[model samples]
Target chain A: MQKDSQKTKLRPGQLSRPKNLNLFTIRLPINALVSILHRATGCVLFLILPVILLLLQFSLSSAQHYETVIAILHSPFIKLMLLGLAWAFFHHFFAGIRHLAMDVHWMTTLMKARYTSKVVLVLGVLATLVLAVKIWM
Target chain B: MLIELLTKRYPGMRAWLTQRLSALVMAVYSVFAVARFLIVQPNSYEAWVDFFQPLWWRIATLLFWISLCIHAWLGIRDVFKDYVPNPSVRDVLDKLLVVSLWVYLVWATWLLLG
Candidate 1:
């Protein structure tokens, strides 16, 4: 009975703790930013699977449909949206490679990890910029 | 050791390894795809069709799709687990995810092979 009372006093219930749910107040570290973006981009990529499949099917269906798909993709608004999606893909891809590297115990230190995080972000944007240039000019 | 971790006893380990392996596979394929696209410069419909004409290319694409389905399934399932606190709602979403991925797998198979 004494031990049980002590346990209760020592460990207050979870609800008694203070909570701050404001997302804006939370400052995410560089590694954390990359990690969360990886997850977000992953979800975005997964959601677009059906559209990709549909586009692929339509493109392969006939020459007319293929040209139509090409024309749709060549539009200005669609090109911008495609750029955004391309960035998401590039971010996810590079960040994912970083993650796999960490899994194998590479760049596991705080400083090295941060450097690689920056590298991943820069590479993603650089690749997207290259693609944008290829698409436009 | 390695084999032990991949068995049914440690399902999370299996998922972890699977995710990494799939990521590697997709990474290789993505690089190859970009290189091929740049080299082939498939600007016309005929050129594009020819780009996918090789049986080996189709097989590799099919493998990539399979890996994608598995990776997406595991990744999205974890996302739902993390964000969705309600068990029943998460369960429904999980079922929907599996069904949709399976449908996509079938659709991709048909598109690629049929």
Candidate 2:
């Protein structure tokens, strides 16, 4: 009976990756959305950390070095990167709050969960834009 | 009462509720700090100094540092809690996290205010 029930291992191409991320039917749920954003933001921050460390090392070297760091920050491309960092920071921050709220059972209802997730993304984007404008101007 | 509050009202479910809550608070202040910096772009050293001179800004910056310290503490504490389950070892590590947070807060305050 056990031998008959045993399944054969599949050969290559027996299973393939999905063609696309289907957002309509069988939608990926809100919790999964938040989880993916959290992981992605974490990865982005990890990549950005070395630049921050470099700034720290240079800033501590001397007043002239500090000025050079400030000048680099003032560059257009670097400004854009910082803008991305700002948004990433805020996006991760709000999503973290959403996670906390879920943990505390404040927004655990299905409707509330989905609605709050949307709100978090909207507010995060709004915040990033506002801060970027402020920094860039 | 405190234990009940943490167990029931804490943001995190299994552990690190305090840390998660601290991070949430820090996020709020961070948005404000960025906004404030944008309000006054302070191109010169004197201008930057003047920006920090406002009593309200000083208080807000103080709170911001406090929040950042708490958030860092929570993250580090969670690491210890997850990896070091031995009660005695965990307790020691937890105390160290708390201490480091205070130390960071003090250093930040000194730099910003003193």
Candidate 3:
């Protein structure tokens, strides 16, 4: 009776504090990591929109400005930076499509989900690489 | 009957559908944009302007931006609703975010039309 009464009080156990922050040691499944990366890239795209829009605004504001902006994008360093942005965009995009498929009940199984995630990652990387080659070489 | 009842009674069902529909539009646009970019490689000023000049492309871009705005607002509102404890404060924060997103959307529209 006392034990049951104590449980009714709703006292939970003490909280444990984690000491290590290392990520590499934990081997997360590919699908889990891919879902995480989707959210991460979504945040990146969300946070960077102001800058992207500002650049677009400048480019559209005037022809002279457009030339200058295009010149800036022509630089190797800027191309590399844009390449990273492209990868984030591509990865987020493909992963988002996979999510939509799941929403529509297309591939809700664990194995199928993981397989689609692998496909998303592969397509994103390949597209990014092709864009990089076209821009740089 | 059950499906209709479920769709009508369930909370946040409309928002969930909105997110998916917007995602569909955005996904299609993303693929088309990538292929167009890869083929044309609009690194020059003239090519860049040319890319935006086509009426069909402009309409597609406009639709994509509209979808993006709707998608983002619903997602952000959901996050604020989940995380923020104070109802009034969350309402204010939500309004602020909505205003900011609208500002960007209007700016993009102007860039497209003007």
- The most accurate candidate by DockQ is 1
Predictions ranked by lDDT, top down? 1, 3, 2
Q: Model 2 over residues A1-137: C-alpha lDDT tens digits? A: 33333454445446533456575766768667776776567546644544654564466455677678789888999889888887777778888878877877898888988899888888878988986887767
Report residue B49 deviation for candidate 1 (angstroms): 0.9
Report chain B TM per candidate: 0.98, 0.68, 0.88
Residues B2-86, model 1: lDDT tens digits: 9999999999999999989998999999999999988999988889889888989999999999999999999999999999999
In the range B15-98, model 2's lDDT, one tens digit per residue, is: 465566566666777768777877887766456557667877777767766766665655556556667989998998788667
Fnat values, candidates in order? 0.78, 0.13, 0.43
The C-alpha stretches of model 3 lying farther than 4 A from their native spots are A1-26, B1-11, B38-43, B79-92
Q: Tell me the tens digit of each residue's lDDT in model 1 across A34-104.
A: 99999999999999999999999999888999999999999999999999999999999999999988888
lDDT of 3: 0.83
In candidate 3 chain B, where is summed lDDT lowest over 10 consecutive residues? B2-11
Clashes of each: 0, 0, 0
- Model 2 misses residue B3 by how many Å? 3.7
Give candidate 1 misplaced runs (Cα > 4 Å): A1-18
Which 10 residues in a row give candidate 2 chain A its minimum summed lDDT?
Answer: A1-10
Question: Cα deviation of A42 in candidate 2 (Å)?
Answer: 5.1
lDDT tens digits, residue span B1-114, model 3: 635644757657767878888988998897799789879887667788898899889889989998988988887776677689999999898898889889888988888876
